[model samples]
Target: MNSFLAIIGRELRIGFADLHRVVTPISFFAVVLVLMPLGLGPSPQLLAKVAPGLVWVVALLAILISADRLFGDDMKEGSLPQLMTLSLALPWVVLAKMLAWWLMAMVPLAVIAPILGMMLGLSTEAAVITFLTLLIGGLGLCLVGGISAALTLSTGAGGALVALIALPLYVPILIFGSAAVEAASLGLAVKPYVLILLAFDFLAVPLAPVAAAAALRIAIDD
Candidate 1:
């Protein structure tokens, strides 16, 4: 629909309008990857073994950090209410914004994840698996993050609250995403875990926007 596309375009403009918004997460992701080698000692075997989980954890955290700003600024600036009044359905608008966020934020993170995995000593198969899982799982992260962002929209303390609300929900994606790579590393079939992840994505992609729309409406009324 024209409205959905317009909303997506608008969100992309807002997202890139400030370079820091995109840079902060990528920088944080890189910094976390860098710290693992330093903090965990110089054990390549150890790093390789933990790389899958570590990458997923860092990516999840980066997503959370960005989610805090997803709607907070709009709420503060009073544009959210106007958006809600638009001709397009609020859920569609929310979905468009989330889609834009995923393209702008998650894509870059996903792209670097494999390279970072290689730097951390992940096997070629593991790195490829990491990339595949992230491609699917990252959307789920955006969906959940959108819901959290909407829920805590106008709350004075959003950052910690968003993490607390989103982290628990993120566990399933983390588990399956890391498990897929671990299975690949062990020469086991990753299809089951990947399927599980796809199931979550199927559920999340539709449900999140509607839930976020409801949360945003409640936020505006309050």
Candidate 2:
């Protein structure tokens, strides 16, 4: 457990050192959320109508862009192989790395969401709900992104390939998460939406590390 913590800390330190990649997508997460109002004009009805889809689209795109950095750096430096051989448990290592990756890429977007949400004319309640939904949904996004990252690491087209593969899977998250917010605005119950988000995340979280580790093994073997 201590080793896993240290490894997570070490990876986070490395991620900070590699801020150029991490920060840009986080920035885009904010930029894209704010783009719709500017592009389509800022009317409350329209913003409410499109906000969910727009948020989902931005979240998906941000995840896609950020996937390239997941295993690419470790694979380049041969650290992935070393991690694979360690007794600390490869799944834990993969989880730590994915969490670090999420912190670098997704957490920032959550923090900055309210500021961006205002541009879409979301009410205080709706903005908070949107942030919460994205928080949960983004975990699944990162987990799935980790898998895609591992799968495509060798191809060097990791970003594009990840987007192609992930987009279909991302649809449910986009639909449910955004639907949650849109539902909230109408005074409807959002528990169902939250539960669905959790179901998706629960499904992805466990499988992601295994899949990523498998991809890493393949990467090392090849």
Candidate 3:
């Protein structure tokens, strides 16, 4: 328990030390939302209709943009091998790092998602749902993306490869996340979609770290 908290603290410090890791995803998320109006033209009805999907898709991509770096710094600093040898379980360590990354990266995106959704013409109800979905669904994104990052850690692949590996896995989250907001926008019941997204996060929280830890071992051994 102490060790898990310590790992999370160390990761948070490292993440804060390098601002790019913290800033890039948020910037990408905001920039894309800002430009969307230009590309799609200023039609409130159209933007409102598509805001759910648009926010979700951009958030997914924003999370993916930084996903490859989840394990990059640890590997480069030779800390990954040492972490594996710790008294604490490697899955716990992986979970700690994922939590830290979610805090530094996903939280900011989730926080701003409602504002961006409104810019895209989402109603107050839909915007609130947008924020909720992104906050929960982003964890699923980080966990699944962490697995991809661990799998390709030794290959020195960039975000492109990470996205390639994780995109298919991301489909369900995107679907449910966007659907929730869309349902809210239409004044329909959003509980079902929100529940599904929560289910994904619940499953990912315990399982993803183990899968990622195994992948890390393989990457380390190779």
Candidate 4:
């Protein structure tokens, strides 16, 4: 228990120490949202219709872009091997790292998502739904992405491999998240989609760390 909290604190400190790691994803997220309207032309109706999907897609990409770095620094610095040898289980350590990554990467995106959604022409209700869905779905993204990051840690493939491995898994979250926002936009019940996103997180939270830990073991062994 002490070790787990220590790992989380250490990861958070490391993440904030390198502000680029924390800022890059959010910057990418904002830049893409800003440029998308220009590329698609300034049609409010069109933007409103596509805003849910666009926001979810861009957010997923931003997470993927940062996923490779999740384990990269630890692995390079020899901290990962040290972590694996700790008294606490590797899965717990992995979960701690994932929690830190979620705080650093996903939380910022979630906080700003509603603002960006409005800029994309989403109604106030839909923008609120976008924020809600992001908070739920982004944790699932971080967990699943952590698995890919662990699996590909020794590959030297970076974000390309992380995206390839994680994108197919990301489909469900993307679908449900976009659906929730869209339903909100149309004044429809978003409960079902929100529930589905919650289900994904429940499954991912416990399972993803174990899978990622196993991958980390394999990564270290090879």
Candidate 5:
């Protein structure tokens, strides 16, 4: 756990160093949530119908925003070069960083879920399920988005590349997460959806880091 925890703490401290950079994207998540009620004219019916997609969409974008910066510092400071030659497998290290990144970005999104839910006219049950979906699904985003960041670290257009690669990957989670809430709103069982999200977590959590480590090695290969 030494390098892993060290990476987590290092990544997290760097993540928050610039408070504006650290918090602004999440503010975007919240602002998008806040604006929906106004845009939809505050009709509870309208809000209910659109809330799930809106929340997932904004959450997706929030993950994308943070993904680009995940490896920026390491790349800039030549740490990635050193990392490539480290004895440890790179993916686990990258995964640890993703965990920290998720904590910084996605957890905030979850914390603000109720407020976002209310703005979208989410029913109590729908809101709870949506929050659960996000809580589970956001980990997958961090894993996948982390790999996207690692894959693009040397490209000089990390942000654009991250969005291009990761946004499409996020679609399934978005679809299911929103669909789960829709099912909940309709009084249907959300068990399948939750299970799907957990499955995603199981797959992405282990696999994405390995892929990210490989990508980092490739990107830094001289």
Candidate 6:
């Protein structure tokens, strides 16, 4: 427990050290959200119809933008291998890093999603649903992104490679998240979509770090 807290604190300090750069992904998320209504010609009905999908796509991309850095610094400083050697479980360490990443990268997007949804003509109910979905879906994004980030820790392509590796895995989460918001907007049952997302989150939250820890070990060994 102490190790987990320490890991998370260390990650948070590192993440916030470059606070301006750390917020770049959030800025991109905001730009995408703001641009969509302009690009789509300002039709309220049309914007509302597409708002859920647009938000999910932008949020996923924002996460991808930050994911590549999750392990890059540690690997570069040779601290990743040292972390791997710790008495604490490597998976927990990975999870701690991911949690810090999520807070830095996704929390801002989650916070702004409702405002963006409203701008896109989504109703109050839809906006709320969008916020919830974005928060949960963001976790899944970081989880899957952690694996890709670890896999590409030694690769030259960096962020592009992380996107390519993680994007396919993001599809199901995007579908379910968008569906949940769409359903809420239409006065349909949304619990099913949210449930699917929760089920995946529950599975991914624990399992992804384990897989990522293994991948990081391999990357370090190579």
Q: lDDT of each model, Cα atoms only? A: 0.90, 0.82, 0.92, 0.94, 0.84, 0.88
**Candidate with more favorable, higher lDDT: 2 or 3:** 3
Q: How many residue pairs collide in each prediction? A: 0, 0, 0, 0, 0, 0
Which stretches in model 6 have alpha-carbon errors above 4 Å?
Answer: none
How much is 131 displaced in model 2, in angstroms? Answer: 1.3
Cα lDDT for residue 139, candidate 6: 88
Off by over 4 Å in 1: none
| Residue-by-residue lDDT tens digits, candidate 6, 138-202 | 88998999999999887747888898889899999999999999999999999999889999889
lDDT digits (tens) for residues 1-222 of candidate 4: 888888889988988889999999999999999999999999999999999999999999999988998999888899989987778999999999999999999999999999999998999999999989999999999999999999899898987989999999999999999999999999999999999999999999999999999999998898
Error of 4 at 85 (Å): 1.5
User: Clashing pairs in model 1?
Assistant: none
- Between prediction 3 and prediction 6, which has the larger TM-score? 3
Worst 10 residues of 3 by lDDT: 152-161
lDDT of 1 by residue, 140-186 (tens): 99999999999988676789999999999999999999999888888
* TM-score of each predicted structure versus truth: 0.97, 0.94, 0.98, 0.98, 0.93, 0.96
Ranking by lDDT: 4, 3, 1, 6, 5, 2
Best by lDDT: 4
The alpha-carbon lDDT assigned to residue 200 of candidate 1 equals 95
Cα distance off (Å), candidate 5, residue 1: 1.3
Better of 2 and 6 by lDDT: 6
lDDT of 3 at 186: 95
1-222, model 2: which lDDT tens digit per residue?
888788778977887887777788877887777666778886789987777667767877977887877888888988988887888778889998888777777778877775677577777777788889888988988888888888887777776798887788788888898898888777788999999999999998888899888888887888
